[model samples]
Target chain A: MSLDPSFVGRTYPPTAPYQVGREKIREFATAIGATDPAYHDPEAARALGHPDVIAPPTFPVVVTMAASRQIIEDPALGVDYSRVVHGDQRFAYTRPVAAGDELVCVNTIEEVTTRGGHGFLTTRTDVSTAAGEQVVAVWSKIVVRGEA
Target chain B: MELPTQTFRVTRADLVRYAGASGDFNPIHWSDRTATKVGLPGVIAHGMFTMALVGRAVTAWAGAPDAVVDFGVRFTRPVVVPDTDEGTEIEVSAVVKEVTEDGLTRLDVTATCLGEKVLSQARATVRMAR
Candidate 1:
């Protein structure tokens, strides 16, 4: 099934604030084998001018994945999640995320198209501090394989 | 200038840990049955996991953990894991594409597994060391 082209430019409501945790950042860094002291020790992070342990560059995906449910699960959109495959990902940061920061995500549908019987959906997530300070912009593209 | 190449091993255990940490419990990353049922060759590494590894390489080249300003990649192929302790390896190398007047360095990165490119159009921009 093809994604509705009209859904392009649709924006979802801001998600509930997610508090970035030091231990979570440590865990993610460990999982990725990022042994930088700034990822594990607050003192090291402080020396680097961060308020707390900073997350890896790709760590925002953890928060955005959950927030994106609003768009992926939209009944009107009629997406078949089982047939989806990731296509592209991009992140532009205003600042690296740090522990104790309260973050929120606003998801917007940037593009929707169909080519070669596959549906291409692109979403842009604006991650920001609860205080409305912009943090990063995350973009993801997923391809819905055609049921041949 | 070309940066030193870095290689990281990817095992099924690593995939399990990444799935838990990243809150992406997609069975295709861990369960072969689910993966095969989904038309995949076998269990596969999450694209985000590969991206994270590339991010590590980029930050290492920039000489800072939080140096990344922009990063992006296209998932051209899956990094298939064959359920072995030996697992697989991803080799990451990059070339300095540009150094901006504002002290940012742009890199064109490449990530490959088993001599096959897994990511395309991979790139990162980082704060150059002062």
Candidate 2:
């Protein structure tokens, strides 16, 4: 089923604050083989002007992906999660996310369209500090394959 | 100018670790049965995992962990992972697209697996080291 075009521009409520942990950053960096010292050592990060060990550039996806469940699971929107495949991803950062930052995400449906019998949905997530400081904006596009 | 190329190996173990770290437990990335059921050839690497690998390349090129200001990619193909210890390899290379007056450098990146492009329209902007 095609997504509702009217759902575009619909914004969801902000998610609960997610406290960024140093070890989590380390674990994520390690998982990606991002061995840069700044990702694991507070002193190394401080040398680069960050308050704590900074997350890798794509780290925000961890939070945004979880936050996006609000839209994907919306029965009204009718997203077939089983048929969904990631199509595109983009991130614009206001500042690097560092450990100890309490983050919140505000999700919005950016676009919804149908093409070639497939449903395409785009979602934008604004990530910010719990104190309301803007951190990063994340965008994701997913394609729902038409029934064969 | 072209930057040095970066390469990464992707094994099922890496996918499992990435799934744990990123909180994306999508069975398609680990379970071959689930993947084939989904019409996928076999167990595949997560799109975010491939993006993260490219992100590593971007930061490494910028010479600063916090240098990336913008990054994006289109997932054009799947990096299918065979159940093998050697796994598959992804080769990442980039060219300097522009260097702004304000010290931001833009890069056009390419990532390929098995000699097939897996990402397109891949790019990154970073704060250049002073």
Candidate 3:
């Protein structure tokens, strides 16, 4: 199914705040074999100038994944979820996400196009604190394969 | 300059743990039935998992935690993990692409499974240690 190019530049409302937790950060770090003390120990993180344990760079995916559902599940978008695959992912940060930060995401449809038999959608999610302090920007590109 | 190479073992249990931690219960990462039904060659590792491991390599090379300012990757291929005790392994290596005047170091990274590139256009920029 082809995506509507018109949807490009559309912005969605801010998602509910996702509170970053120390244990969640630890779990994510452990899963990837990242034993950095800043990801697990608060004192260690504080020594590095963080308020608390810091999350791994990719940890924002936990929030943006749910936030993106607004776009992917839009009936008008006509995305066939079964045929979808992650094509690209990117993250740029203003500061590391620390445990106890209430992070919110505002998602935007950066681009929508079709090539051959597939649909490509690019989304940019701006993550910020509830107080509106920007923390990071995450970009995701997904490919919707044509029916076989 | 080339960074030291690192290898990580990915077992079926690791995938399950990652899925739970990352909240990606797509089933394709754990269920062979769901994976094969979806045209996959048995259960596969999550592309994000592979990226996270690469992130570890990048931070290690930078010699600082929380130093990454930019990171990106293209998922070019899947890492198929067989149902065995020793599932599979991914090897991550990188080269310093540039060091900016503003104290940032950029790295071009490569992650491979079974000698086939699984991630392409992989790169990261990190704050140089003070």
Candidate 4:
């Protein structure tokens, strides 16, 4: 099924607040095998002028993808997950994510198209704090295989 | 196990195995012909695969994978995997950047591919076990 081109530029409701805990950061770091002290030591992070432990830049993907489900799972959107593969992902940041920040994400369908017999869905998720502090913008592309 | 930093020679074979494991068969990653068509010297490794490796490196330090909360990086330059004489061994290094009262720590990272900065201005946060 073809994605709705009209969905392009459509923005979804903000995600529920996700508390940025220190342990969560560490788990993610561990999962990726990061060993930098700043990822676990406040003094190390403070030496760098940050308020607290800063999360790795790519950390937002956890929440970003969660928020994207609003659109990807929309029955009307026609995106078949089993047939989809990651195409691309990019991140632009205003500042590093710090612990203790209660963040929210707003997902937007940036573009929809068909290429090489695949359905392409591009999305942009803007992440920020509930207090409205801009964190980062994540852009991702997924390709759904042609119907069997 | 005490977390030990790894420094290995990044070979074309290493990159291919990574692509296979990650399910990223992007032509630019393993096909020199495709890379040349796109103006790269040879194959270019997937940015995410590198990121994955970096993540694994950090997580290994923490001794638990699920403890990481967030991680991100910028692709400063492509890590062109040269086929001749084998590929270059890329070096990845990270230092503590910041720590919060909540016991979360952020890391400043640098990854060099063939003596050139491939991933820069990287950051990650990890929560310690309480």
Candidate 5:
């Protein structure tokens, strides 16, 4: 089934605040083999001007992915999760996400289209501090393959 | 104009760890049965994981952990990992695309696995470390 273009510009409510933890950042950094000291040591991070341990550039995906469920699970959208393949991802950061920060995501459907009998869904997630400070804007595009 | 190249090894264990860390416990990344059932050759690394590895390379090049200001990539091919101890390898390399007057350095990044490009239109902009 093709994606409904009408879903474009649809915005979801902000997710509950997620407290960033130092252990989570360290785990993610280790999983990706990022050996940077700032990713694990708070002092190293502070030396680089961050308040605490800093997450990698793509770390926001760990949060935005769950936030995006609000859109993909919408019955009106008709997305087949089994057939979804990530197409593109991008991030623009106002600052690094530091451990101990409380973050919330506001999701928006930026585009929807059909090509080659497949559906493409694009979403933009605005991540901000619980206090309303913007941290990053993340964009993701997924292609839902048509059944053979 | 050219930055140093960095290589990362991907293993089944690494995928498992990443899945746990990232909360992306997709069976295709761990279960060979599920992967074959889904038409994938075998277990495949998450595209986000691959992107994160490249992000590491970007920050290393910029010489600071919080240097990245913008980053993007298109997943062109899957980085298929075998069920072996050695798994596979991905090589990440970049060249300076441009340096803005505002202290941002743009890089044209490339990531390849098994000699095939895995990410396209890969680019990053980083704030130079003072």
Candidate 6:
């Protein structure tokens, strides 16, 4: 099925608030093999003038993944989840994500195009704190395989 | 161990090798003219590849490459690798910021290109060996 052009500019409800814990930040950093002290040590971050342990920029993926459920599961979109691959990812940040912050995500379908029997879908998630302070915008391109 | 500040002369070859190792082959990484056409100053390195190098620096510092518990970074700016005789060595490094009660290690990371930051507001964590 073709993507719904009408879905362009559609916005999903903000995801449930997620608290950014130092340990979780640490876990994310470690899982990706990062060894930055600022990710877990408040003092180290404070020395750099950060209020707390600062989360790495990619840390927003946790909530972004949850927020994307709305887009991938949209019955109108007709995306085959089984054949999807992560084509690309990027983030534009207004500020670094810090620990101890409560944040949520709002995802918007930016574009949908099909080529060579493949569907290319782009999703942008605007991530921010519950207080509405924007942290970053994550853009992802996913390609779905054609039906055999 | 005292943290080291790194500066690299990254050649196009380095970027290609990185793509091979990381499984990220975004054309923007290898095609110079394509990169210029895309409004980038020049070909830039993948943000994740930069993150991976920084991750390597951190894990090496932690005394175990596989001991890191988590790592992530945001791409604030793109590292425009210039097309020159040599290339670019992404100035990627980390500073030990703190150690938690549970003994997790935290480090603030930064990667720069030609004096401009490519990945900013970055951080990582490593679990120390007992």
Q: Compare the candidates by DockQ and give the number of the best one.
A: 1
In candidate 5, how many Å is residue A55 off?
Answer: 0.6
Predicted candidate 6: what Cα RMSD to the true structure? 12.4
Candidate 6 Cα outliers beyond 4 Å, as residue runs: B1-130
Candidate 6 residue lDDT tens string, A1-148? 3566677778888888888788777766654445668776889878766788876555666667667878898887888775665565666666667887888899888888878888888888988999999877888777786764
| lDDT by residue (tens digit), candidate 2, A1-148 | 6888999999999999999999999999999999999999999999988999999999999899889999999999999999999999999999999999999999999999999999999999999999999999999999999997
- Give me the displacement of residue A94 in model 3, in angstroms: 0.4
Q: lDDT of all the models against the reference?
A: 0.96, 0.95, 0.94, 0.72, 0.95, 0.71
The best candidate by lDDT is: 1
- Model 4 segments beyond 4 Å from truth? B1-50, B54-130
lDDT per residue (tens digit) for residues B1-130 in model 4: 2234455455677667655543456688778887787566788776776776676566655454344655666666777778866676667777776778988777776778767877766666776455
Q: Give the TM-score of candidate 4.
A: 0.59
Q: What does candidate 6's lDDT look like per residue over B1-130, in tens digits?
A: 3378766565677677655544456678889877766566778876665665665676566665334555555566776677776776777677778888988888888777777777655766676645
B32-130: candidate 2 lDDT, tens digit per residue = 999999889999999999999999999888888898999999999999999999999999999999999988999999999999999999999999776
Error of 3 at B114 (Å): 0.6
User: How far in Å is the alpha carbon of B86 misplaced in model 6?
Assistant: 30
Off by over 4 Å in 1: none
Error of 6 at A77 (Å): 1.4
- Chain A TM-scores in order: 0.98, 0.98, 0.98, 0.95, 0.98, 0.93
In the predicted model 5, the residue pairs found to clash are: none
Model 4 lDDT per residue over A2-46, tens place: 787888898999999989888777766554445677778778778
Instruction: Tell me the lDDT of model 4 at B29.
Output: 76
Error of 2 at B30 (Å): 0.5
Candidates ranked by lDDT: 1, 2, 5, 3, 4, 6
Among incorrect, acceptable, medium and high, the docking class of model 2 is high
The TM-scores of all predictions, comma-separated, are 0.99, 0.99, 0.98, 0.59, 0.98, 0.56
lDDT of 4 at B17: 64
Interface RMSD of each: 0.3, 0.5, 0.6, 7.6, 0.5, 9.7
